[model samples]
Target: MFGRTKEPPAAAQPAEPSAAQPGQGKGRPTPTRAEREAANRRPLVPTDRRAASASSKEALRAERRRVQQGRINGEEKYLALRDRGPVKRFVRDVVDSRRNLGEYFLPFVLVLLLVQLAVSSSGNNVLFLASYALLYVGLIAVVVDSLLLRRKVRRLVAAKFGDEALFRTGVVGYAVMRALQLRRSRIPKPQVTRGQKVA
Candidate 1:
């Protein structure tokens, strides 16, 4: 060997691949700004019982109200199982479009309650009996109306969705409850007026 020291061998360099081909390197679409922000956030899982309970209750109430107002999608994380389709919408439309004696039941009950308060203060037996009789009659009428509407709803749901059992998921009872609610207090506010013929 001469006086010169042997030089170290050069390392092999990896060749960078060419830019991704049309479909080759587009693995996943870029995440949205919101998605990125959310990804970066560490959610505060409240450990305090009262704080957690309050947060949960508020969330539930807000979501329930949203669903009741028909502002939520069927696929939404918080949507109620009962509010999950056009079927319920159709049912609501049918119920809202028709004239239902049951709709007045709540207001009538309120009146009866006031009357009872008055009768209690008076201590009048005959008047109390008359008021009670009226309340009973009103309740019976509401019940009969609910039953009739239940049958009609089944028929209509069958006609529209092609199966009587299409409304089998407590829809009849739901319709009954909805019918009994005060009109102004009903959620997803009525689109059709009383006596309006449903097309």
Candidate 2:
């Protein structure tokens, strides 16, 4: 007891371990604010700008193709605003079920142009007048056909759906546009054959 005085109260307790034991945490000190911010930072520009651009373009092209195919398949979800809804679908069926003079307008005009050119080359005043007369007649016929189509579509839609169906914007124009397009060139391809009755 004299040689080694009684152990002091402070030294009597065992010292606690200062460092973390293995597997006790990340085994590193907590990161400072600057260290965290630097670790999280990203470059403003892509490393491969050309590749990124090409990839984005390819993605957009693929999406367009998907939408186009969906439209051709007559999927309502993929259809454009102008082509959506059962009302529009009924209108498409009505137009597709019959032949419209408007679809022939382009071909008729082409023939008229050829006739006009031939007449001009031959300096035939009678033929020139005839071609002009024919063009006017064709334009009038197309207009008449479009008006009839609008009437028929409105009547059919109102009969099947309701008068309120006529209130939708651009319904007549949509039908007319579809009728004007060549049969083979129509989008959301026609579900019914020509002369097929539309229900």
Candidate 3:
């Protein structure tokens, strides 16, 4: 056994520092800051003026057409927005609402007349006269009101849109408008009454 451990040989010492960093020790050349800046500062020069002009004119025409179409679209949108609520209310009232006299009056009058005729078969008396009067009046009123409503709806549609196609377009516009308005409107949650119990 050796009395003391021998040190490593001096020939096996670490190597000297090179001129470049570790990765650049090979022959690869790195770009200087000036070269990078010069590359960045180069302007994008346009070539082919005829082609550019043609494309540019096409783009300009497209933009102008888009603007014109937008204006036309905006007018319809504005009108639809303005008229939506009133039109909705009107249509709902017309289509869904009951005709108080038309639905009930005619039937009521008929029933009364039948009962009167069955009860008093012998005479043209006061009851008979009154029954006839009520029947005729109710029938007339129902007919008149129905005709009036039909005429009003027709006139309104014709005046507003001029034709069925335009009328349908208007309707679609109104529907879109109403949908937009509804989206914008905030709906409040229903409040429970004091006596009500939750399911």
Give the CA lDDT, 0 to 100, for residue 147 in model 3: 62
Error of 3 at 10 (Å): 57
The ten-residue window of minimal lDDT in model 1 covers 70-79
Q: Candidate 2, residue 174: CA error in Å?
A: 2.0
lDDT of each: 0.76, 0.92, 0.51
Q: Rank the candidates by TM-score, best first.
A: 2, 1, 3
Q: Could you tell me which residue pairs clash in candidate 1?
A: none
Which regions of candidate 3 deviate over 4 angstroms? 1-93, 97-100, 121-124, 159-161, 165-199
lDDT of 1 by residue, 77-193 (tens): 444667446667677777888778887877787898898889989998888888889989998998888888989888887887768456456677778888887776766567677
Q: How close is candidate 2 to the true structure, as a TM-score?
A: 0.72
Taking all chains together, the TM-score of candidate 1 against the true structure is: 0.59
Report per-prediction Cα RMSD to one decimal.
9.8, 6.8, 21.7
Q: Which is the better candidate, 1 or 2, if ranked by TM-score?
A: 2
